[model samples]
Target chain A: MIKSLVSITGVALVCAALLAGVRYQTAPHIRANREAATWAVAFQLAGGPFPTNNVTLPLANLRIGGTRLDTVSTPGYGGSIEMLVALDRGSIGGVKVTRHEETPGLGDFIEGEWMNQFEQMQPMEVDTISGATITSLAIKRALQSHLRTALAETAPEGPPG
Target chain B: MTFRQAAIERNPAWVQLLGLCPLLAVSNSVVNALGLAFASTFVMAGSALIISLLRTLIPHDVRLPCFMMVIATFTTCAVMLLEAYTFDLYLSIALFVQIIVTNCMILGRLEAFAARQPPRAALADALGTSCGFAIALLVLGSVREIIGAGSLGAGLDSLFGPDAADWGIDFTDEGGGMLVALLPPGAFILAGLLLGLGRGIHEQRQARAHLRETEG
Candidate 1:
């Protein structure tokens, strides 16, 4: 009994040490990669790179021609679809699906060129994907609703025309 | 088990049908398949090594927990490496990679072979099994990518560096391929056909050997 306890403990300790070493070496690179990906989309949405060192997510006030970058989450076919939507001048400047649990191959269309339909559009008028109608409609609804609220709050003159 | 038997005859993906979840899910593209193959191979071999080295020390009753811990550690390592280096590719297949620890193939090898074998033999079995799985993944990935996307190595740049951006052959115009081939039903159909083909070849080889023996 004593030997078994000691052996398991030893294995656990060794495994933990090995993982800690790997994490220490790779953590910085992972962080940098994530930051780079997010910022690349941010720059693309703003139409140009702008300086903002400490911007938070889901509600980033990107000081670039009145662009409000916010994260939106809505129920998708498989699970929640979390997207980073940039609203510029009451229209979507750019949209990026940061996380989702939709069915692969079908619902994953949102991650590809299908998302481009939402760009530069306020009401998000686009046809739903053939097999992924629910996911597509969910994204359309979320973006349009968010845009309505955002426009209403900013303009203080009710919903947009 | 011999490398030949482990890698070809009693293969994990083909013969045992283990780890089919990631196999079918990530095999939609060659780059994704290779990425997963590399990660699975690393985790399997790494865990096998650690388990074999400590096999005698681990109590039989508590071996399962020990193996789980070891496998999880290696899987985590693979995840970190992929996220840091192949960020884009990793993002697409991140879910599959995270679940590598639960892959029955890895655990099966650990329990059936690694636990009892010496370090060298255990490592060999792990490598052989992983290679077999990789071959399955590559074949399925290639077929799916070709018929589904009309391209091979379509995302090479994501797995390799930027220099490999144009490495994939474009057999058709963009978005002109059969969409169903990239879907789950495609994976299932192709996998079933490939398995049947493998078994047919194996049976033919055995029959030929038996016929030669009788004639001699």
Candidate 2:
């Protein structure tokens, strides 16, 4: 009995040590990659070169050539959908679904060419796709909230003519 | 056993019918298939080596649970490594990777081969089994990706890197592609056809050998 206990404990300890070693070694690189990916996706949605160095919060206050870009997350059919919405003078410049977990074939229509419809429309007027209603609505709702926050932040400067 | 025998004649995927859940789930795309294959191979070989080395120390009653712990540890390591280096591919197949701990092929090898064999032989068996699994996944993934999407190597970029984004073939003009080929039924149908083809080839080889023996 004692032998069995000792052997099992030793093996478990060794396995734990190995796992910890790998996690420790890879944690830094993983964090760096994640940061780089966020910036890449943000830049893609922003459309062309932006002042990466000047941006305070890449996800919230992304400013590029008189346009403001903000990322928002909302629940989709499968999981949360992360969208990058570009705003220019109170109208949507462009909207891109940066990340989502919707069904591959069916719900993925939100990522299709049809998403161009969301561009140049007011957030409340954006229509959801037929089959992918939930995912589409998620993006719309996220945009609505982001627009509210963005407008309130710039509201102090008085209405731009 | 020889690598050839393990890979083909006594194949783990088709012949033994082991680890079919992952075999079917991730084989929808070549990149997903290759990612899972690499992760599984790493876990299988690592587990086999460690289990074989400690086989004598483990008590008979607790061996199964001990083997499982070892397999789970290796699987966790694979998941962490994949997440760190290949975040996109890791997200695509994270569920499958987590379930690798429960793969019967790994447990079966530990019980049937690893425990009784020396470390060197255990490593060879693990490699052979992994090769067989990888071959099966690649063949199924390629066939499904080509027929379903009307393109080959559609998502190679996810597995390789950004440079491979242009590596995918586009056949959008080929009559809109086959939706069924990318679904679950497609995996089942393709797997069945491949199994039949393998069996037919084996039978023909046996018949030729018999004919040569008679002529002699």
Candidate 3:
């Protein structure tokens, strides 16, 4: 009993220490990678380069080129999907799922060309992908509700650049 | 076991039917298969080597825990490295990689082979087993990608560098292919056919050997 306990304890301690070391070394790089991917999508949605090349995240409402970009999270097949929705002149300029826990082969269609169906279309007139009904409905519902409030605010005049 | 036997004759994924969950999940694309294969290779070899070296110190009663810790540690390390270096590939297959610790193939090898072998022998087994698993994944991935997506290596850029974006070959125009081949059920169908093919080959080889013996 003593030997088993000691062996497990020693093994656990060593593995934990090893993982800590690896985490310390890779944490910064992982953070940078995620930030870069998010920014890449953000820039793509906004239609061009930001005024400043050195801008970092926490962009505060994420407005670019008169388009309002919102990070919306809605319940998907497996869990909540975080999407970057670009609202441009009452139409969807672009849509990108920044994060999702949906099943890979089933619900991943949202991140592919299937999402192009929403591009330049009125938010409320979108149809969900056939196989990925739950995920698509979640994204569509979120966008419609979000648009209801957003369009009302910007209806008086076009969104400010 | 010899490397040849481990890799082919008694293949982990094919013969043992171990690690089928991740195999089917990530084998949808060639790039995804290669990414998982690379990570699995690193984790299997690393954990096997560590376990063999510490086998004597590990008590029989607690050997399972020790093996689990080693395998989990290597899996975490693989994930970190992939995230830091090949973040694109990591993003595409993050869930699969994180679950490598639960892959019975690794734990099975550690228990049945590594715990009783020398470090060098254990490393050889690890490499051979990894190769076997990689072969199964690559075969399933290639067939699925080609028939299902109408392309081969379509997303090679994610695994290889940006320069490899054009490495893929598209058989159909406008990216049209049999969509069912890329779906979850497609994995099972392709895997089953491939297993049958493998079994046929094995039986053929054995029959020929038996014929030679009988004639002799």
Maximum-DockQ candidate: 3
- Please tell me how candidate 1 rates in CAPRI terms: medium
Model 1 lDDT at residue B84 = 89
Worst 10 residues of 3 chain B by lDDT: B1-10
Kindly report which residue pairs in candidate 3 clash with one another: none
Q: DockQ of all candidates, in order?
A: 0.73, 0.59, 0.73
**What lDDT tens digits, residue by residue, belong to model 3 across residues A1-161?**
98888888888988999899999999999998977888788878888767646555544356776898777778999998887778878778788888788887789888888777778575556776688888888888887877777777677676664
Q: Output the TM-score of candidate 3.
A: 0.81
Two-way DockQ contest, 1 vs 2, winner = 1
User: Which of the CAPRI classes, incorrect, acceptable, medium or high, describes model 2?
Assistant: medium
Candidate scoring better on lDDT of 1 and 2: 1
Superposition TM-score, candidate 2 onto the true structure: 0.76
lDDT of 2: 0.85
Each candidate's number of clashing pairs is 0, 0, 0
Model 2, residue B172: distance off in Å is: 8.9
| lDDT (Cα, tens digit) per residue for candidate 2, span A6-69 | 9899899989999999999999988777666767767776677566665644377666778888
**TM-score of chain A for the candidates in order shown:** 0.70, 0.69, 0.77
